[model samples]
Target: MGEKLIYMDHAATTYVKPQVVEAMLPFFTEKFGNASSIYTIGRESKKAIEESREKVSDAIGAQAREIFFTGSGTEADNWAIKGVAYANKSKGNHIITTNIEHHAVLHTCQYLENDGFEVTYLPVDENGLVTPQQVADAIKPNTILITIMFANNEIGTIQPIAEIGAIAKEKGIYFHTDAVQAIGNIAINVKDMNIDLMSMSAHKFYGPKGVGALYVRKGVKLVSFIHGGAQERGRRASTENIPAIVGFGKAIELATANLDEYNKKIMALRDRTIDEITKKIPFVKLNGHREKRLPGNVNLSFQFIEGESLLLMLDMKGIAASSGSACTSGSLDPSHVLLAIGLPHEIAHGSLRLTFGDENTDEDVNKLLEVLPVIVERLREMSPLYENVKRGNKNV
Candidate 1:
């Protein structure tokens, strides 16, 4: 048998499911048509779009008309934040979000600040949790919108989204959540959560990349972020991506159908991996709340090691993992999420995220549990920081 390549980077992206590919194949060839044209082929494409919209909406317990396809989760996030910010600018210039939000929401908020909007970035606890009380405290008369993520991308800390949403509703402020990481892993209901706007990406689930959606609650007004055609009810404009939309719809169906079973199985492996890694590796710390995180997430920080060096070593062993958010991997900075949760810069620099997927088995977990301790030990021996610590040099 060939050597196994354990892929543990599901948080970064998941492989497209075979079912999803089968669902999308016909659309790419025989059914190829612009969703905009009024001809027969075009009508078929339009029908597929609407069907996909319903599937996605149903998965999230949202209405069919509320779903609008976008090019990516980032686009959905940008449109949700900037669209709401600009539309409600007359209502108030203040917005509230957490300090640990994904860059899509964070950068958009920063851009709005340049346009004279006031934003309050709430801090998280050491467990990477933002309390409802903290959000309630941040509310002001001028606060118009509150956008927080459903779950953290790097640490996998599931936020109190419904609680925050309730606070936003009671204050009459629009609530939006970047659910890119949370969509397929947990249940989401826009109505129960009191969410006015939300974002999702297909790639996070077992679907194709470069396709995502924004959920706008009916009666919530959003300014158009993209303008050209009448597609997406004139709110978002572009020719709809038909094949990817079909794959997204099918993927959501599969993910929803098997969510409970998948979570139960994956969480077992995840917990076992966490326990073994922490017990075997001294000076290793797990990030995020122990119980209040995604089932597949296992984030850890190894002392006296650089995360990139660790990733390279793991790659040589044919295991795939991540140091931080793939979006910011090329950057030199330590994860903002880790630093926000009280990890010292040096400690944060050694963080690793081994997010599991449906395909990850106990054997894979065992392989990691076996290899990781050895890698960390080897790395620490070569680490100058470890040497300093060993020599009783506290100043370093």
Candidate 2:
């Protein structure tokens, strides 16, 4: 706690930018009227919502009418999967998705399975990449949708989304990508990629939390995930979160406008940190693709130590990171994303996710590198597993 806190968990969420906050202020106070109302203030709020829609659509090359706002990325994901499934039940009853998907998509697929929809869980390669060929092979006549994440949240592996989308297009199946992590970090053209549906979150890119958008291609019929009012063109029913939506739009504008500069700076710092840690540490393995991954993502596993212990030690040093071993179930289950990429339970148990962001710098990386090895060594010294390896007693 003595060290200045270094936040390397941008993948979890990002701090809202000042510009975004400024843009949202009007919606929260002065222009605070329900978009559903017909009064002057309501009309103004409604107009702002539409403008935000257009900005989001233009950023992703989608039609403004096709953008549906939701409370969160998970909501959008559930809507896309279940909406397509229910809407196209007569056409098909099977959906295909990867095992590495976030719990939002994975759990929805599981729920669909219980409701009598067949689901094909595709596997990934050693680098956590799902191949288009595997997706193609998994398709059946009853396959109605394919939902794969654009980039893995934990491992930062970019999937072959374009290839998979093309295959789905050729086969007349809907393709949906949860691009929550990929939206700010990479360029996504829905039309160019032939994606039928895509989901994005605001908080992942310096926007306010609890606001997200789903892109549904024109002419794609889907049942409503939320049924009540005409908001989101009746696709989703809820009063528009005006302030958060405005903030989301501003955040996107800023992120895209400064994408190149941010990429260069963050990538440089991230790579330096990775290089330093790997060069100085023992038996460390880098997870995910080296070159084809996100600019600010660095995931690694240090053998002979538990991920929770490492995370706790890092916390003591005021280095904020995440480990795959921490779970909502309160069980030390290995991250499903890590295991899907072919890591053994022990290796996956030691996984660390260090996602960089705008505020990070070379000095921060140097500080992390300075403290990390000592922490790892201290933990390994108490680890019976490490002692056995050092003594040439290989038995577990």
Candidate 3:
């Protein structure tokens, strides 16, 4: 009866789940109390906060004391990088990261560089993968921290985090991963992964926005990033956001409850979408590793057409997708992740990213497969580059 709406940008963010919202609603009104207050309601607030902390910790196989809430994944990332960098500055000034990290990690590393820190941005292969050996080779005695993302936001490539973590562990360097894109999508044990510090955003996993957590391993030296109150064990300060924290805990609990099943379902839909699209469209390239990527991610680059044009046409068809990370979508430049994976500027500009979620279904994939080929064809017909190719112009 109405226009169909299909959303496939779960990598950017997910809508809050009903169960998470239900868990949070009471905290906003009747449970409203400052966690720092000394009253009974305040004590209740503190209890809820700690319970949420334990939930977050358990989700990632961490200890209750290790979880510290932050304003967002970006803040968690900033604190992890700068906090570790400053605390261990006496030891070394060099940090190692990948060239394809989210700006949250990349920008923080850049900021530290301005503060006299040296960062080694390791390059990835054409599939956007960096080897643990490369990390080992890049290490200098002054390398104090190794901050690589668990998975890429744009390309959906899951790095060998455990191997890198092991390398960092052997080298006695603090390892941090911006797991904003990997959390809740894949099974993660911070301990098994040998991660010293990790970052997460609740909104990426069907929890509310404005709440995230950083997992700091015991004995990790991290200088206080926020200096004010005594909150977050004197590390991060500010009044605790109880509602959002509750939601985060509940969201992760639900997400991890049946991780394998969720991945199986989403991966099926993702594969179908990829297969159908590639079969129908010519001159299309898959952006990430075919088997080693996130289950729900499908990134493709279509030749001879601009990503913006394709997105506009998909929007008209009631299909919501993305050209790159939503945080960097406003930029006209091609995605750095695409370029790092060896896509030429033209193909990189034409890249599309579709990330599925629990709510996505076969119908959604069907709609996408039905409409995307037609859209690509329509846009390419309007492209002068495509016309030149048709005319046998070899330069393009």
Most accurate candidate by lDDT: 3
Off by over 4 Å in 3: 391-396
* Candidate 1 lDDT tens digits, 1-396: 255799999999999999999999989898998988889999999999999999999999999999999999999999998888888888999999999999999999999999999999999999999999999999998998999999999999999999999999998999999999999999889999999999999999999999999999998868999899999988888888899999999999888887899899989988998898888987889999999999899999998989999999898888999998999999889999999999999999999999999999888988887888889999999988788777885534
CA lDDT of each candidate? Answer: 0.93, 0.90, 0.94
Question: What lDDT score is found at residue 65 in candidate 3?
Answer: 98
- State residue 368's C-alpha deviation in candidate 1, in Å: 0.7
Clash count list over all predictions: 0, 0, 0
User: TM per model?
Assistant: 0.97, 0.97, 0.98
Number of colliding residue pairs in model 1: 0
lDDT of 1: 0.93
Which ranking of candidates, highest lDDT first? 3, 1, 2
Q: How much is the lDDT of residue 271 in candidate 2?
A: 85
Give the winner by TM-score: 2 or 3. Answer: 3
lDDT of 2 by residue, 1-396 (tens): 477999998998899988999999998888999999999999999999999998899899998999988999999999999999999999989999989898999999999999999999988888999889999999998899999999988888898888988999999999999999999999889999999999999999999999999999998879998888888777788788999999888888888877888899999987887898899997899999998899999999989889888888898988999884222324578888888888899988998899999999888888899889999999889888899888985544
Single out the weakest 10-residue window by summed lDDT for candidate 2: 323-332
Ranking by TM-score: 3, 1, 2
